[model samples]
Target: MRIDLHTHSTRSDGTDAPGDLVRKAKLEGLDAIALTDHDATEGWDEAQAAADEVGLRLIRGIEISTQFEGLSVHLLGYEFDPTHEPLVQELGRVLGGRNDRLPRLLDKLAGLGMPLTEQDVLAGARDAAAWGRPHVADAMIAKGYIKDRDEAFRDWLVPGKPAYVGRYSADLFEAVRLVCQAGGKPVIAHAWARDSGTKITPELLAELTEAGLAGLEIDHPDHDARDRAALAAIADDLGLAKTGSSDHHGTGKGPAFHLGANLTDPAELERLLA
Candidate 1:
């Protein structure tokens, strides 16, 4: 009954293909895995087919980029109707933003004396639905400008860095409502990570619960013990399902993000999908 509820594939920032990610998850002893590619549902069918072939349960999901109080927040939506018009339209805008920012990102990098063509970045994107920072990082890696995604972000791509470029993101509250409207369960992904948790107070959590937030991700590689404890308590108070996941990004992330490094309890999975 082991389930890891968040991961990515070549459809987004992760290195693995949809089917490869599924096969790897099966080999890692995961009974269930969710393909939560960033803002895209293109990987769902392929991942689902692979999961079926491997005798694994697949939870179709997306890790939507959203903004809350001027901070970036990721929302995980599961089992949604991918064709829901409004949701689909919103995803299109997000993907468009990702694509639209590529040239600007490259321009910034070129200004910093590291010129790259769109083809260079696209070469790393593979089957990705859109271009993103990770693909840019991969391009940088290819140019030997950085060793990995970590160094790339630390030096150039992250906010306040020279290569940083702003992009459109959905409003968090609206995103939650949209996911619910699309017949999906919406959960905050790694709610306590990257100092975003400091803004998600109990009062805000209560408000989001009313706004159709179904769960909170409590176990993640980025969350320490204290953060998990506090988030768990808040989730308990709000009657929200508590989720755990590896947040696997294939080789795009560190070893701590290995598949099934963190897992959701079966009962919690039931609660989340209820």
Candidate 2:
């Protein structure tokens, strides 16, 4: 069966609505797709309903932002009850931080000579509920702020960049706990990126695994052959799962990879859902 366990919707930073994502998935002939929006479950109800309409199995999921040793990371939660109190509370804090940071980032961008306004971003991000970089990037693209998403990050949105601001994020251990407590399987999202230097080390994976890390996201647009080999080795050594996924974010995110583009096997999905 074709399954893509990681994806987003406009509920967070993705470009499409949950229903649109469902339609796209069906067009691709995906057997299943997970609507792992960031830090919010409001989209889940819509996604689930749409999945039922399209006859596609839906996995309740989210990609929560988190921190580990001061670096930013995203935790993927699958099969979880989105309203679990503790998880909800933690996600609230993250959202609050997200809401607060965007304004500061926009101001910072202005200071750095980028002509941007909150209204511009708000208008562009229309349904993004929680403010995010993608909205800012869209505004940037519209305003000719930097050429595109990559340029925006390279100039102002990346860590330590002029417009960079931090959000209140959970640690790897806490993120894992929340996912498990919410009855979800916790997986690390998109860990194999060598060009931008986002590599998930074995030691880091071990630490998270000790704290209930369920899997590593070995499939992503940024991962090269070497990156995949290293991730596969790390998963083997640690007895952790290595997943193949597209990490699709609609268009303008480079060659749109489909649901099963990088999947190494189907066994892991069955094992996880079990």
Candidate 3:
């Protein structure tokens, strides 16, 4: 069975709505797909309904924003009770931080002479449960400020860029603990991508394994062959399940990713689900 465990929808920064995302996944011939919208599970019900209709196994998940040693990280939580109080509260705070940072980001953009209004950004966000840099980048695209999301980030949204702004994220160890408390499997998403890899050393992975982190998203568009091999070795040493996914964000994420561009092993899926 083909399974792609990381994806997004309009409930977060993806270009497709929840139902549409599922339908597209079905069309792409995916046997199973996870809706891992950033910081929110609002899309789960609709995506699940669509998955049921299409006979696709749905993995309800959230890509939580987290921090470790002052660096940003993403934690993927799967099969958790969405109503769990502590997890819900933390996600709310993280979404709040996303909301709070918008004006500052826009202000920075304005300073750079690419002023984009709140209405423009909101319009770009469509029905997203959480607004973030990708939505802002969409707004920029609408205004002809950039060609696509990658350019938007390269030019402004990435760390140390002129329009970049910091926001709140759960502490990494605390995030893993909360996911476990919520009865979900916690995996570090794209753990060794870009500069974030510096913060996710083997030593740290071992520590997180001790903290109940169940897996590592070793196969991702951002992880090259060498990166995946190294991460897989660490997962083996730590006895963590290794997951692979496209991290699909729809067309907005460019051609680098497609549904099932990368897939998790069926055995690994069982391990994660177990």
Off by over 4 Å in 1: 195-199
lDDT of 2 by residue, 83-178 (tens): 789998999888888889877887777788776888888887757659888788889899876787877777777776778777788777898998
Report the poorest 10 consecutive residues by lDDT, candidate 3. 192-201
- The positional error of residue 244 in candidate 3, measured at the CA in angstroms, is 0.6
Candidate 3: which stretches are off by over 4 Å? 195-199
lDDT of each: 0.93, 0.79, 0.91
Worst 10 residues of 1 by lDDT: 192-201
Sort the candidates on TM-score, descending order: 3, 1, 2
Model 1 alpha-carbon miss at residue 77, Å: 0.2
Q: Residues 1-274, candidate 3: write the lDDT tens digits.
A: 9999999999899989999999999999999999999999999999999999999999999999999888788999999989999989999999999999999999999999999899999998888877899999999988998898889888788887788899999999999999999999999999888644364789988999999999999899989899899999999999999999999998878666788999999999999889
In model 3, the Cα lDDT at residue 1 comes to: 91
TM-scores of the candidates are: 0.98, 0.93, 0.98
lDDT of 2: 0.79
The 10 consecutive residues of candidate 2 with the worst lDDT sum are 256-265
If ranked by lDDT, best first, what sequence of candidates would result?
1, 3, 2
* Candidate 2 Cα outliers beyond 4 Å, as residue runs: 195-198, 256-260
Question: Which candidate achieves the best lDDT against the true structure?
Answer: 1
